[model samples]
Target chain A: MTNAIETTNLTRRYGKTTALANLNLSVAQGSIYGFIGPNGAGKTTTLRLLAGLLEPSSGEIRLLNQKLSGSGTEAQRLVGYMPDFFGVYDDLRVWEYLDFFARCYGLDHARRRTTVEQLLDLVDLTPRRNDFVQNLSRGMQQRLCLAHALVHDPPILLLDEPASGLDPRARVELRELLRTLREMGKTIVLSSHILSELAEICTEIGIIDCGQMIVSGSVDAVRQQLQGGSHLRIRILGAVEPAVEALQNTPAASRLPAIAEVRVDSSDERVLHVELANATEETQAALLTHLVTSGILVSEYHAQTENLENLFLRLTEVMS
Target chain B: MKNVQFISLQPNPIIIKELRIRMRGIRPYAILTIFLIALVAAGYGMYHLMLRQALFGGSMLSFQVGQGLFSGLALCEICLIVFLAPAMTSGAISSEREQLTYEMLLATPLRPASILWGKLVAALSYIFLLIFAAVPVFSVVLMFGGIAPWDLLKVFLLLLITAITCGTIGLFCSSLLRRTSQATVISYSAILVLIGSTMMAGSLWSYFSGPIWQPVPPELLYLNPFSALISIVTVTPATSTDFFFGGDVFGLPLLSQFAAGVVHYGPNGPVVLPIYRATIVFYLILTVALYWISTHLVLPRRRWIPRWSDVTFAVLLAVLIGGTWLTHDWWRVLPPPSI
Candidate 1:
C-alpha cells in the first residue's frame, strides 16, 4: 500500500526552542493514525506543518504523493485540515457556513448545494441547516467544523485535538463519524492528549515527547514491544492461603524463572495473581499442571493480556 | 487563458458570505436611515438659510441657494464616507483572525489576493449603498438651478474613488495589525494624515510662497481629495483656463477651462486643472500596490507574484517615475505663461 502522508526530517524551530525535532513520520493510506503527546509536545505544530499552514524550517512533506513545499494550491487541495480551535460567523446560517467553505474549495453552485446538504446529512445536522451557527451548542459546532473539514473530500484529514471539549456522547458520535470516514478510505491523522480516545479509534499510534517521536507502529505491535510478558489470575474458592503457599513451593515455579512472582490480590483476598517473565504458553501450561497435581485448591485460572494503555504508560514513564 | 478561466469560474465566496451576513442584520438598515436623515436635514437647513437672505433677487437668489445646498451636502457626504470607510474595512481581516476563522480560510484553496479583493469589495459596496441612498437628497438641490447633472455625477464618482482608496488603506492596516482595535486606530490615523496634513501643508506652502503664484499650490492640492473636491466644484473654464500651460499641457486641455466641466484641447479650449483626476489615479495605483503587498504579508510563503513580485514592484516604480515625467507641468515651481 502506498503511504498517504510522509515527512522527511520535519523539524520546526521557534528561535532557540525546537517545536518538532528531526521527525520522520509515515501514515499509511486509509489508516487512522493517532498522534499522542502531552501539552506543548509539538503535536499541533506537526499537524500545522502537514496542513501547509506553517512552512517547515528545513524539511519536506508529501501528501497524497505530491510534494507540499512550493507546490502552491495543488498540495493544499489534497488535504483537509481542522485546527484545535476555529470560529464560526454568527450571522451566517449553518448551511451558509458549509456553503461558503464548499465554495472556497472551488465547488460550483449546484455542487455546493448538493455537497452541503450531503455533509449536513452525514453529520446529522440537516435539521439545523437553516439555523444560525451561534445558536448551536458546542457539540453541534464541533460537528459543523468536522463537516467543514470534509467539504472538499480530500484524501487526507489532519485534525488537532478533535475530541477535547466534546461530551462523552458527542465523543462517541465523533468516533463513529471517524469510523465511517475510515470506511470510505480517508487517511486520518489526528492529535489528542486523550489516550483513551485515540486507543479506541486509532489503528496506528505515534507517541511524541519533548519534540521527539518516542514510539510509533501498529497499535498491537507497539503494545507488544512494550509488554514484558503475560499475566495470570488464579481464583481460589476456599482456603486461599494454602493455595498461595503451595504455588510458591511447586517444583515448576522453581525450575522455570518464567514464573517470576506470585502475590495475593490486594482488593480481592480470594484471588492470587502471577507475573510471568518471558514465559511461553508451554511453560504456563506446565505451571498450571504442577499446581493442580500439588493438591492445591485452584478453582479457576485465566490469562489476562496487556492493552495499549499499559504500553503507553510504560513508554511515557521511561521517557519521563 | 487557463488562469483567467480558473479565476472566472471561482466565485468569490468571501464577498457573498460577508454581504449576506452584513445585510441580514438590522444594523445596515439603521445606518442607512440615519445617514439619509442627516443629509436631508443638512440640505434643508442650507436651503432655508439661503431663503432668508434677500441680498440677491429672483434667479440669482435661487442659483445661490442651489449652489449652497449642493456644496454643503456634497462636503458632508465626503466627510461621512471618509469616516465610514475605515469602520467598515479596518476589521476585514483582523476580525477573521480574532474570530479564529483566518487559519481555516487560509487552509482552503483560496488565495490571499482573492480574500483581500473580496473584503475590499464587500466594504466598499456597503458604503456605496449609503452614497446611493443620498442621491435623492442631493437631487433636491437640482430643483433650484446652480449645479448641473454632470457636476453631481463628478462628485459621486470622486466620492466612490475616495472610498475605495480609504478602504484599501484600512485593509492594509488590518492585514498588518493583529488586533482589530489597533487596525482601526491606525487606519483612521492614516486617513486623517492623508486628508488633514495635505491640506494644511498646501495652505502653509501657499502662505509662505507669496501671492503671485497660485496660493494653495495645485500640486499639493492634488494630493488631498477634499481639496480636489473643492477645486472641482468652484473653478470655471474662463477663470482657470488662461492661467496655466496656455490652457493645455501635453496637448490635453484642462477640465477647469470648460464651462461644462469637460476637457477640450486648443489655445481657446478649456484648460481643466485635473487636480481631482491626478488624485484619483494616484490613489488608485497606491491602493492596488498596498493591497498587493498586504496579500503577501498575510501569506508570506505563497505570494501573489510567484518569485517576480520584486520585479513587478520594480516595474511599478518605473511606472511611477514615468507618470511623474508625464505630469511635469503640474509639479513645476513656476506657473506656466498664459497664452
Candidate 2:
C-alpha cells in the first residue's frame, strides 16, 4: 500500500542550527501516527514541512506518492493541516470563520454551507455558532480549529500539537474527535508530548529526539522492546517469610525448570512480588507445585501491564 | 483549458477579509483619527485665512477650499500616509507568523502570488480608505477659489503612490522580520532612505557641480519619485490653469481689495503651475515596481526567504553608508604639499 506521507533524506537548517537532519519518515495510509518529542525536537518542523509551510533546504517529500513541489497544488488539495498555534480573527463569529475557510477551499455555495454546518455539529460548535472565536473556551477554540482543518474534507490531516494547552476534559474531547476521524479512514499525523494521549489513540508511534527518530512501532512492540524482564506479583494470605522460605527451599520457585532468571521486588508479611526472565508455563507449574507441597498459600498472580509512560521513558532515556 | 477555467477568483475574497481586519481594531482607528483631526483643523485654518483676506483686506482675494495650499500640510499628509502604510503591511506576514496562519494559508491550494497579492492590495486599500476619509476637507477648497479639478486629481494620485510604495516596503520588511515592531521600524527607515536618500545625493551632487555643470542633466533630479512629482506639477501651468475661473469665486475680488495683496506682495509671488501628466506616469510605474518586488520575493519556490535577504541588504547598506562618509571629500582639501 502507498504511504500517506513519504520523505527521502529531508534536511533543513537555520543558520548554524540544523532543525531537521537527513530525516526520513513514512506514514502509512489509514493509520494514526503519534509523533512524540520534547521541545526543539523538530516535530513541529516536520509537520510544517509536510504541510508545505516551509521549503526544504534539500531532499524531497511525497504526499500520496505525488512529488511535493510548487506545482503540487493538487496534492495540497488533498491535505488538511492545523498549525501549533493558529490565529482566528477573534472577532469573527464561529460559523463565519468556518464559512470563510470553506469559501477559501473553493467549495460551492450550497455545499459550503452544508459542509460548514456539518463540521460545526461534528465539532459541537453549532450552539455557539454566532459567538466570536475569542469568546470560546480554549478547548472549543481547538475543536473549531479542527473543524476548520476538516472543512475541506481532505484525505490526510497533519495536526501540530492540537491538544496543547487544553484542559483535561477538552483533551479528552479532542482525543474522542480524533478517534472518530480515525474511524472514518482518514490518515492522521499528529505530534504531542502527552504520551498517554498518543498511546490511547495512535495505531503507530514514532519517538523523535533532536531531529532524529529513535524508535517507531506499534504500542505492544514498543512495550516489549522496553520490557527488561518478566515481572510477576503475588499476594498471599499467610505469613510472607514462611512463603518466601518455602519458595526458596522448593525447586519450583527458585530453581524451577524452563526459567532463565528471577528477581524479588519486595517481601511483605502477606505477599511476594518477583521478576522473572523467560519463565514458561512449565516453570510456573513447578513453582505452584512446590508451593502446594510446602503448604504455602498463594493469593493472586498476574503479569505487570506496562504503561506507555515506561516505554517512552525507556526510549528517551536510551537516547539521552 | 481545464486548469485555466477552474477555481476562478471571482470575488477576490481576501480584500474584504483584510479590510475588516484593518478597520476593526481600535488602535488603527485611533492613529487614523489623529491624522483626520489634523487635516480638518489645517483645512479649516486655511479656509479662514482666505476668508479674512477676502473680507477685510483690499487685495486680490482668491478663495476656494483646496486640499491644502502650504507644503507643511502636504508633508503631514505624506507622513500620515507613509506612517499608516507600515502599520498595515508590517502586520501582514508577522501576524501570520504569530498565529501560524501562514501555515494554514500555505496548506491551501492558493498560489503564493494570490496570498501575497491579497495582502498587498488589502494594505494599500486600507491606506486608500484613510486618504478617502479626508477627501471632504479637500473638496471644500473648491467653493471659494479658482481650484483646478485636475490638480486635485493629481494630489489624490500622489497619495495613492505614497501609500502603495511605502506599504509594499512595509510588507516586504514584514516578510523579512519575525518581529512586527522590528519590521515596522526597518520598513520605515528603508522608505525614508528611498525617498530622502536620492534628494540628499542630488543636493550634494548639485553642490559639487557648482554652476560649472549645473544643467548637465535636469533628469537626474527625477530619479527621486517625490522630486519628479513636485517638479512636474510646479513647473508647468498650461495644463492645470483654470483660465475661465482664474478670477476669484466672487469675481475680480471687488477691484478695491486687489491693492492690499498686490502692494504688499510683489509679482515675485509663486504662481500656480499647470498639472503635468508625466508625474502621474512616474508615480504609477514606481508604485507598480515596488508591488512587483513585494510579491516576487514571496514565491514559495524561491529558496530565499525574506528575512535573510533583508538582513544581508541591511548589512550591505551600512557598509555603503560608511564607505560614502569616509571617502567623500565634503570638506575642502588643502593643495598637495610639494608632491
Candidate 3:
C-alpha cells in the first residue's frame, strides 16, 4: 500500500539539543498508526514537523507523495493537525470558530456554511453550535478543535497526544470517531506516551525512545518479533505437585520436547506456570494429553496473554 | 483551477474576525463617546477663552477665534491619535501569542503578509471612526469663517496617515516582542522619540547654527507629525508668499527671525517644501517598510536570504525616498490662483 506520510532522515535541533534525530517514518494509507514513546521523546516535535509548523533542521517530509517544500501549503492542504495543547478563542461561538478556519482555507460563503454544519454534526457538537467556544467543557472543546482541523477536509490527520487529557468516556468516544474516520479512508497518525491507550485501536504501532523508532509493524507481528517464546498457565484439578513432577521427568531423548521450566503460582499453589521453548497448537495439545493420560487431571491449560504495557516496558529497558 | 486562484485574492479572514470581536463589545462605544465628549469640551473652552479675550481687549476678531478653535481641535486630535493608535494595535500579534492562538493561525495556509495587513486594517479602521466622529466639532470652526474646507480635509488626512503609521509601528513592535505590555511600552517609546526628540534636536540645531537667516533643514522634522499639523494650521495664502520669501516661521512668530528658513537649494534656487507634505511622504514610506518587516517577523519559517522581489522592493524604496529628497519642491502646492 502507498504511504500517506513519509519522512526521510528527519532531524530537528534547538541549539545543541536535538529534539528529533535522523529518523525515517512511513505511515500507510487508511491505517491508524500510533507513535508510542516516553515524555520528551520527540513525539510532539515529530508531529509538528510533519504538520509543517516547524522546519526540520535537516531532512525531508512528503505527504501523499508530494514533497513538502516552500511554505508547504500544497502538502499542508492534505493533512490536518490537532496540537496536544491548544486554546479556543474567547467570545467566538462554536460554529463561528469552524467558519473562521473554513474561511482561512478560502472556502466560499455557501460552502463554509455547509462545511461548518457538517463538522458540527460530525463532532456531535450541533447542540452547542451557538454556544461560546470558551464556555464548552474540556472534552467538547477538544472535539471542537478536531472539527477545526477537519474544516479543510484533509485526507490525513496528525494528532499529538489526542487522548491525553480526555476522560475515559471521552477517550472511548474519540476512538470510535477515529474508527469512523478510518472507515471513510483517512489515514491517521497519533502520538501517546501510554501504550494501552493506542494498543487496542491502533492498526500499527511504532515504539520510539530517545528520538528513534525501536520497532513498528502490525500488532501481532511486533509482539511475535519481540517475544521469542511463549508462556503458559496450567491449573491441575488436584494438587499441582504431581503434574509438575511429570512435566519435568519427561526424557530428554523422547520425541516430545522437554519443558523449559515449571513453577507453582505464588498466590495459588494449585496452578503451575510453565515456560515452553517453542509453542504450536499440536505441541500444546500433546502436552495437554500427556498430563491427562498420566492420571494427572488437568483442569485448565492456556498460553498467558502479554499486554503491550509489558512489551513497552521491556523494550525501553533493553534500550536504556 | 481558476476559481482557486481567484479565492486567494479575497479579503483576509483575520480582518473579519478581528473586526467582529472589536465591534461586538461595549468598550469601543464607551471609548468613542468619551473621545467625542473630550473634543467638544475642549472646543467649548477654547471658544469661551476667545470670547473673554475679545471682550477684555477688543482685539481678537471672529476669524482669529475660528483659527484658534481649529488649532486647538487639531492639536487635541493629534494628541489622541498619538496616545491611542499604538495602544489599539500594539497587542494585535502579541496577544495572539499570549492566548496560544498564534500557532494555529500560522499552521493555516494564510500568508504572513495577509495576517499583518488584516490586523493593520482592522485596528486603523476604528481609529478612522474616531477621527470621523469628531467631524461635527471640527465643522464648528467653519461657522466662524477662518478655517477652509480644504484645510479641514488636509487635517483629517494627516490624522488618518498618522494613525496608519503609528499602527504599523505598534504592529512591528508586537511582532518583535512576545508580550503585549512590552510591545506597547516599546511602541510608545518609539513614538515619543519620533515626536519629542526630533523637535528638541531641531530646536537645538537651530539654536547652535547661530544665524537668524540660516534655514533649519526640513529633514529633522519630517518624522514629527505634530510639526506637520502645526505647519498646516499656520500656513495660509496670505502668509505663504512671505513664507517663501523668508518672512516669518509660520506659527512661531517670535522666533521667526531666528528660524526664518527651511529653504532647499534646488535647481531653481531656494525651494520651500512644506513640512506637512514632507511628513506625509516620509510616513507613507515608513508605514510600508514597517509593515514589510512585521510580516517577515510573523512568518513561521522566514527565509533569511533576500529574494529577488525583496531586493527590488528595497531598490524601489531607496529611489522613491532619494528622488523625493532631491526634488523637494515637486510636491509644492501652488498658491490657489490669486483671487
Q: How well is each residue in B33-79 modelled by candidate 1, as lDDT tens digits?
A: 99888888877765655554443332234655676666677778888
Each model's DockQ score? 0.40, 0.41, 0.39
Cα TM-score per model: 0.87, 0.78, 0.88
Label model 3 with its docking quality class.
Answer: acceptable
Superposition TM-score, candidate 3 onto the true structure? 0.88
In model 2, the runs with Cα more than 4 Å from the true position are: A8-26, A55-60, A70-75, A245-269, A279-294, B1-6, B25-40, B51-58, B63-79, B133-136, B194-282, B299-301, B304-339
Interface RMSD of each: 5.5, 5.2, 3.7
The candidate that wins on lDDT is 3
Interface root mean square deviation for model 2, in Å? Answer: 5.2
lDDT of 2 by residue, A1-320 (tens): 99988889898888788888887888899999999888899999888788777777888999989889854465567678898887777867899888777767777677778888889999999999989899999999999988888877888898999999999999999999998898887899999988898999998888888888777778667666667555566676766667667655545336564333333444454556665565656676667777767777777866675777777777778788
Ranking by DockQ: 2, 1, 3
Q: Once superposed on the true structure, which residue ranges of model 3 sit more than 4 Å away at CA?
A: A250-261, B1-6, B55-58, B202-217, B235-273, B308-312, B315-319, B330-339
**Interface quality of candidate 3 as DockQ:** 0.39
Ranking by TM-score: 3, 1, 2
Evaluated on chain B only, candidate 3 has a TM-score of 0.81
Q: Chain A TM-score per candidate?
A: 0.92, 0.87, 0.94
Tens digits of lDDT, candidate 1, A87-189:
8888899999999998887877777788899899999999999999999988899989989988888888889999989899999999999999999889999
Of candidates 3 and 2, the better by DockQ: 2
Q: Model 1, residue B53: displacement in angstroms?
A: 4.0
lDDT score, candidate 2, position A138: 90
